[model samples]
Target chain A: MMNCKEATQLLSEKLDRPLDTKEKVMLGVHTAMCSSCKQFGRQMEDIRSLAKQYSKGKQTEEKK
Target chain B: MIEANPSLSASEAPNAALFYDQEFMESLRSQMVKFATLQVQDAQLAEDAVQEAMLSAYQNIDKFGRQAALKTWVFSILKNKLIDLLRKEKRTTVASQLENGPNLQGDALMDHLFKENGHWQKSERPQKWDDPDHGVENEHFWRVFDACLTALPEKYGRFFMMREFLEMATPEICHNEDISVSSLNVTLYRARLRLRECLEDNWYQAKESGS
Candidate 1:
């Protein structure tokens, strides 16, 4: 089994939907228990959400 | 959304709209522009790169092979155009490293990846959820979220733009960049790791400020 860091590393791959069943379950279980990994997952989402916003904002600016 | 074509004149090739749908092209406009921006590092030039690449694809739509997705093919052309622009402008351009500022200079290995002033300039944490029972929207959350992204590493910044903003798939990304799948995955992992750390640090700070 991978440690917290290793599992955290795979979190992006999981986010990308490239992980297999066992890997997915392992990361899910790990993030469930690991505080840092949980934080990481949230940040991954935060960055993405913001990036989308920035793109949209820029799009709007261009329209104006 | 591109409507699939239901009819074509006999002997007329299904190449033009097949290679790219007009409405889909409109949706992909900003995405291509964003991808070119990160690659070329200049907004105007990036726009030019995207325009040139799109035109080139349109002209040679019939030559596009099925080996790559149309998006990937367009991105490849944009990448080539960016490289060409970089070469032409190399003699005049300054070598300023791209950054979001709060410049932290250190010889330490780990410290090189972060800034000294810390993530968010403003410490308000936004509301993650909206409730009809409770009062309105959570605007603060968006502010903190934007700050976290501005704090990640530059390489990760472009990678994030290419994948999330441009909407390219992992397999296509690997093929376009000519990088191994594992390397691309590792790059994404590190990018996510940095972003995760930045978000956690700010979320706690926001709580501190709110309290």
Candidate 2:
């Protein structure tokens, strides 16, 4: 089982690209057991989504 | 607001509805200039690049197939211009060294939060910033977010913009940066870690304290 440290690292990496099967399984198991890492994963997703929107400013909204 | 300003597009091209409208173009220019300034870190140079981008975009408006939003297409043009600017600056500035050198401080900061056993210290565990609408709806939240991003190391901030804002693929980033994929990942990981910590301190925690 990957530790929280390794699991968190994978969580960030998975944002940039797809994890391999082994990495996905390990992260899945680790996050399943670790609430902190799970929260970290969610936050990372939020940051990614928010950053994308924020970086583009309100252009997307104006277009709509 | 733009739709209400019908005079802005009354005498413009048929594609004026697609962003050629004067008022819309003015707003887009300012936004593009702001975005470019963040990436370039120089207001004057950012404005110049935005100008070039706007000219190119206008000249090639017919080439636009409407397959993508006008803003996306225009931003892509601006991004290409910014990349060109960065490439030029890379030769004359310290950007090459910053990109190639070890980010020792980023590593030390991360290590300070975790232990030898690869676990977060009780004091350092990530906290929930549970406001779901903070990033989406609140304009003030973005000001704080921008401050946190500005606090990052310059190279890291630039890299983050390339990957996230410009929507460049990792492989393309690696090739353009002349770094290995693993190296790029490490840089990006450290950038996120630092931004997360900074935002937690300046935005989330501050909000909690105020409330």
Candidate 3:
């Protein structure tokens, strides 16, 4: 079984590139059993989206 | 030279008058400087790059009609300036050297977060982040976000910005920085882990406690 460290590393890499079949399978098995890893995966996705919004200058304030 | 896109009708394009608005210009300059500073990691150099990009934009503003959003056009120019500065400054070697520094030890933070068995440290496991989408919309949340990003180690922050903010592809970044794919992956992975941990501690937990 892939451990949380490996699982989380794969999750981060998923943001930069597509996972291979073997990696996808290992990550699937790991995250399926690990709630913490599952949550970590979700948060990674959230960070990516937040970073995108940030780059586009999305902000609520009218001034700095 | 900026060229007008014939495909864009007059109404579809952003109002050119916004270029002359003081508030708009101030906001644009701030955003540009913030981005450039993060990438170049030098305030004086960042300012110079932004000023040069803005000057070029101003000189060619007449030709900028309908080609792209004004902000996008300006940023493209700034991106070029940043690339030039980065090349001249030779930041890539510094980043790679830091990656190999004795203290790096293949990432001390990774060891702190993960146990010998590769499981999350009991106290270090990720907690539920409440309402992250809503958090992104909040101004205070952005402040926390910026603080977290800025707090990252300089090497990690620069590569993270190159990939995330500048939207450079992974291979492109590896080639430009002269690092291997695995090394870049490790850097980005560490960055995301640290950033998430920082936000959760400083922002979400604070909000939960305050409200």
Highest TM-score scorer: 3
Order of quality (TM-score)? 3, 2, 1
Best by lDDT: 3
Ordered list by lDDT, greatest first: 3, 2, 1
Q: For each candidate, C-alpha RMSD in Å? A: 11.7, 6.5, 6.5
* Per-residue accuracy of model 3 over B103-143 as CA lDDT, tens digit each: 33355888889999999999999999986766776778988
**Structure candidate 2, residue pairs in collision:** none
DockQ of candidate 2? 0.44
Show where candidate 1 strays beyond 4 Å: A42-50, A53-64, B1-36, B41-44, B47-144
lDDT of 1 by residue, B46-136 (tens): 8888888877865666676542256657766776676567446642222124433342211231234322332211222222422211111
CA lDDT, every prediction?
0.56, 0.74, 0.80
Model 2 agreement with the true structure over B1-211: per-residue lDDT tens digits? 3443456452354454655457878888888987898677689999999888876766566666553367767787898888887666642333446643334335586687778788887776888886646444555776788787766776787778888877778887776666778877877887888788777777777788988
Provide fnat values for all models in the order shown: 0.27, 0.53, 0.74
What C-alpha RMSD does candidate 3 show over the true interface residues after superposing them? 3.6
| Model 3 chain B poorest 10 in a row by lDDT | B1-10
Cα error, candidate 1, residue B80 (Å) = 16
Q: Give all TM-scores, in the order shown.
A: 0.49, 0.71, 0.75
Task: Give chain B TM-scores in order.
Answer: 0.45, 0.63, 0.68
Q: How many clashes (backbone atoms < 3 Å, residues ≥3 apart in a chain or on different chains) does model 3 have?
A: 0
Candidate 2 segments exceeding 4 Å error: A59-64, B1-48, B54-77, B83-96, B99-104
